[model samples]
Target: MGKITGFLDYPRLGETSEAPAQRRKHWREFIRHLGDADASTQAARCMDCGIPFCHNGCPVNNLIPDFNELVHQQDWRRALEVLHSTNNFPEFTGRICPAPCESACTLNINSEAVGIKSIEHKIIDKGWEEGWVTAQPAARPSGKSVAVVGSGPAGLAAAQQLARAGHAVTVFEKSDRIGGLLRYGIPDFKLDKMLIDRRVEQLRGEGVQFRTGVFVGDAGAGSAYDKVETIAPEQLKQDFDAVVIAGGAETPRDLPVPGRELNGVHFAMDFLPQQNKVVAGDRLDRQILATAKNVVVIGGGDTGSDCVGTSNRHGAASVTQFELLPQPPLQENKPLVWPYWPIRLRTSSSHEEGCQRDWAVATKCFNDDGAGNVCSLTAVRLEWKDGRMAEIAGSEFEVPAGLVLLAMGFVSPLQHVLDAFGVEKDARGNARAGTDDYRTSVDRVFAAGDMRRGQSLVVWAIREGRQCARAVDEYLMGGSLLPR
Candidate 1:
């Protein structure tokens, strides 16, 4: 409401980015946040709608209009405060989140929605540059302790909140590094790792302890990392008053077709982590490189698009992405789905880097090159009727590929970890925990993020983590001042 008619005067302005050809040469963030002037103009477009559906649209229920008005009024410091009040890591979400809030904007019914995400990106970055972002240690200690398993967004968010609530928080991570998925699963081109490092330091200043290379489960539970010290679930339950299992879903959905055992076929997780490790200056004896190879990434999602960008940077001969489902409409029926997330075709920056994308095609089998390596794949076109898919008659085709990366998304959390904790699981194998209490069946155990809700967005992970922290705090102190 900073400018009553600003929505009619201004159009949506997205952030600028480096050209694909130039950006593909290196592994670094290429997209630049909006400048102060552009951000203010964009924020001005926030219409004084009676109800802010963007609040419900955002997983953290970010005060979008409040920050937008602050930015429009050129109050950068206040805007950052409003942003950090809800989102623990706006920088991460600003970079990777899909911005469901924008889709739910009141002005989005017909005109373009305001650039809320970009404004958030600007506000946080400016806060850091101005030294406005700092540690907020608790004034008094609650004397309670918490053990958080997994150091991803959810676990980190929970640790930060509990620590600020005057509880001693220790975060356990299987990897040698602090960030779990953020440190490995995502490419540096999309999000710079230094951002995570700064936040880690901030949390450390707030009295949160990070125990890397420590698996909080059985040693034989098949942790991806080696040389990690295993701590039994019972030990954590005894050492700490409460435990929060915020470990993310890591079980990748596999394509169990013929020749799945081929050498060139790998899960996106395995391939992606190696590249990130290499980028972090860790040399690997054997790395999966898409260099000069015809790479076929199965699954048309953000992960697949990431593969495309990474492959392009690796100088792949070609990159092709496949989707089993039919393509969505470029533009959604906004009137029908206004104030809600609409299913529309989304083209990520990576997709624009150069990728041949196909939809409604299912891989039949991987063709072998006679050396236990994948050479090509047989696929069939499919048609959907009444929510059922049927293969088109005699439409099988073969595409040459030296590498295949499965990016079909994760199914659930590692069952062994949950089993070690002896927590009950839901039908989908996620830890059975209600949002209100976030308590697992086991005493003093809680679950949040993907561990409880199955695989989801980063923003949802943060929301669950914050709420889970409040639940744990209340369980311990019999009352909590922390927000849900």
Candidate 2:
């Protein structure tokens, strides 16, 4: 520990964000990391307890206390090494992870937990600035080739690891640009695309080949390799020694209520991706516009928060987010929920910008204003009996709405791809590959991330990717050295 009583002396110092009014102006990262001295002080808050539950809390099993101690000692380079040893993309996680590690900190049981996430942000940012981060290309080629489908966190992490292990790795992305959801799904205000671009550059330097704008199933088109060839499922199995499927959970959960086909109504994923593309300077010829329109975003998760932020950026006249469940308490019970992410109201930075949030409300119908366009939303107050919801009497209300975005979460990976691979799907509609096996029904083809584990956090995706790479390596070499 930096100092025995430092936890008591220096209170937890967290990252600061640009004022909402200022940050809403542009699609840029708003959070700022703490400086050296302040960050060190914050790091000192770690008690460095004997049993660090943080290891369990972090999906990647990041060595938190050691790094916190390193940060506290002002050895940021060491902190970065510790941070990167387990997590391939510390910068990404440091920025967006919910920091369950902090929640499980021993200090959190009695006091504010160590500023693990903020410290991680500072460490990686410092490493990048100091030129400590560099590509570690493989020494000799293993002569084995691997094809990784999808360019999301899982695919990227697996490709990087496999490339470093001397295997030729080529990542295939259907999108025009790589980085998948990171490049298009998430808003720039949360994670800037430039960061992803830099990481891509590093991966390219490590001899990882990225093939974009080529759909895997639709393989007759001219590809970067100048091969207008289609590889059948069996063809891929024969051509490549190993295949990894990391496609996202793209199947959106639909609302099957009446009037669901209204003109102004759209899925949250549909709306968010378009906005991200437009912000990236790709002018969508017929993009949906929230400007001068009232927007109602259904679903109370991060996607809804993203919708709220995007609508504010688009200069919408009004914005509202709806949740079917009842509102949670402002604060979670520490004694009951300690070390585990608890149920509590979390107002994201986007929600803070501008948006009306409602809970315990269910949408009933969407009506058109006789112009073949959505002009209003019909909803009803919900009453919970036991665990079911019932519409409360006299609480039916119609809210004016121009654009209605469905921000509900995804249900599963696209069945087309899964069916093409002949992979078994679990009850939740995800690939039936457990963390232990990491392999699908077919041999040599591995699955990870949302494709295997269902929709989850980027951090979990990274963890699954890394572990899956190790499993693949073990299957190839009988014994492997890659970290799990």
Candidate 3:
């Protein structure tokens, strides 16, 4: 809307990353943000489309056209305000989101979509550089208390919103630090840990209390990432007026095949968090290292791609990724799937670095070396017909795999946590709660994020958290002024 003819004059310009050879040497963010002029030009490409489907495309419903116009006008202050109005953490989404908003752009029908994500990235980065980001503390206290369980995007979002609304908010994290998946599940190469630390500082300034290494459940010992300081589930109910369960889906889907007990096979969650800890200057007695070993990452998803990138950084001899489903088309059929998420092949930066990617391949079993160490993987090709999958005859093969990382994705939240709260569960085993109210069967308990919706993107988690906060506020008070 800033420039009527800008779309015709400018082509989409994306952020550039350092060469794989150079970037893999360190665990830092390598993607460079666009310059001011370039970012303005990209923002100017936003058309005055009668309806902005991109707003709906974004899970958080970001005001895309408004921010684009502000960036094009070089009003960085206003741009940041507009971004923060909807998203609590644009820096996170701008860096990692799949950008469904661009896929739903009207210009995408016949031309390249406007670089909305890049513009967002530029705005947020500029905000931090100009010292525009600061803590927003409430002027008055509401005299109510809320306990937010877990500190992922959802929990963090809800805590910030609730705190701003003048309620006393305390976030409990099972891990040693805040940010559940963002802190541990994601690889450091894509997202630096300092970003999370920056936000944590701001959140503390906003009057949100963070209780780390405090497991609020059936009070038990913690895992390798966090040592346990137990808090009974009933204690939270007695202390806080309301409790929001934002603990994400952590029950990983397992591949129970032969040699699963081998020494080298591990869940992606177990493998990824260790590397993050090491990067943060923590020493581990027994760390899973991919160095000089043939690594096989099973499952074609973001987690699997992360495994490939981390393995490459570890100087693995080779990295191979396996996908159970058939490959999708390189390009989407926009005519048929316009204004919605499309089925298309996505090549992550990790895949481009160096990886052998195969689709429609299913692992049958893990083969072990003589000492009960995983040495190879047996797999078979599959054929899909009429929505049914069948293995092809004579397609069995084995590949060298000194280390195997299972990244098939999470199945549900840990049942013990749900049982501790005594909350009802959905058919998928997610915490039973509706988005309309986010209220669980228990009167004062609520659920959001992956705990309520199952596995999803970071953006969706943030959206759920924000909405859940509003629901809690409305229930606590008569109504809330917070945006939905």
Candidate 4:
């Protein structure tokens, strides 16, 4: 440990951010990473705990204490190396991932956990600024080929690893550009798209080929990529030695209620991607805008919070969010759930930007105006008993809403893509494959990330991708030196 009693001496320091009122005027990242001195101080707060529960909390199993010590010792280069050893893109996780590792910190039982995520953000940013983050191309070619479907975090991670293992990797994306969801699903204010472009360039330098606007499935698959060129699954099997399906779960859960067909009612995916595309300099003829409209976002997860943030930037008249479940406690029972993620109320930057949030409420139906646009919605308060919800008697109310966005999260990957590959599906409609080999029922095909595990965090997707890459390398070469 760099400082034995640093945890007792220093309080946790968080990243500074622009005020909500000021930041709401533009679609750009408002949060600033910690300075070097502040980061070192924060890193010094890592207690020399015998067992680092943060390893169990972090999906990618990052070397938390090691990196923290390196940072505290002012060894920036070594800290970056330790970080990149496990996480392919710390920038993404640093910006978007909910720090479960902090929750599991031993010090968090009574005091604030170490600022692990902020330190990571500082390390990666410094690495990029110093030009230390560069391509690590393989020493020699292995004379093998792999085809990766989708260009999200999972697929990109898998492709980078396989490429570094001396294999030819080609990533296929249905969208016109790389980064499936990271380029479209997420808003620019949270994560700058330039980070994705930088990583793509590094992957290219490593001999990884990226084929955008190409769908590796049947032409009439359920995806909305109408103009993409479709490649048959047989063609990939015949051309490439192995295939990795790391596409994200794109099938959004729907709210099947009255007036679902209204003009202003939309799924969060439908509304979010348009704004992202616009931010990327793509002009759309019909963009979904929350400008001057009373926006109602249904769902209580990250996606819903994103909607609230975007609406605020759009100058929305009013923003309201609804959660079907009861509100969690303001603070968790630390004694009962220490060293593990706990259920507690979380207020995101989007929530702080200004949103009226309600819990234990369920939308009964979307109300329609004279035209086909949604004007309001009817909802009822709920009472929970025995883990079941029942509507309260005569507690129905109407809320004015010109725009309704359903951000209830995704259920599974598009079934048509799985059908095209002839891969079996689990009860949850995720691709049926075990993590041991990441091998699908279909020979020479493997599944990873959200395609196999359903909806999860970005860190989990990176972990699955790295593991799947090792599995594919072993399957092709009969053995692999890549990390599991």
Tell me, by lDDT, which candidate is best: 4
lDDT by residue (tens digit), candidate 3, 283-337 = 9999999999999999999999999999999999999999999999999999999
lDDT of 1 at 219: 55
Q: How far off is residue 352 in model 3, in Å?
A: 1.1
Candidate 4 stretches with Cα past 4 Å from truth are: 219-223
Q: What lDDT, from 0 to 1, does candidate 4 have?
A: 0.95
**RMSD in Å for model 4:** 0.9
For model 2, residues 1-484, the per-residue Cα lDDT tens digits are: 7677888898877789999999888988999999999998888887747899999999999998889889989988889899999999989999888889988888887788888889889999999999999999999998888899889999999999999998889888878888878877899889988888889999999999988865666443343323533445666678789999998888788888777898999998888889889888898888887899999999999888889999999999999999999999998888889889878899899988999999999889999888788999899999888879988999999999999999889998877678878888899888898798599988889999989988889999999999988888888878778999
**Separate clash counts for every candidate:** 0, 0, 0, 0
User: lDDT tens string, model 4, 415-456?
Assistant: 888999999999999999999999999999999999999998
Cα-based TM-score, every candidate? 0.99, 0.96, 0.98, 0.99
lDDT on C-alpha atoms for all candidate structures: 0.94, 0.87, 0.93, 0.95
Whole-model lDDT, candidate 2?
Answer: 0.87
Reference-based lDDT, residue 380, model 3: 98
Candidate 3 residue 183 Cα shift, in angstroms, is 0.2
TM-score of 2: 0.96
Better of 1 and 3 by lDDT: 1
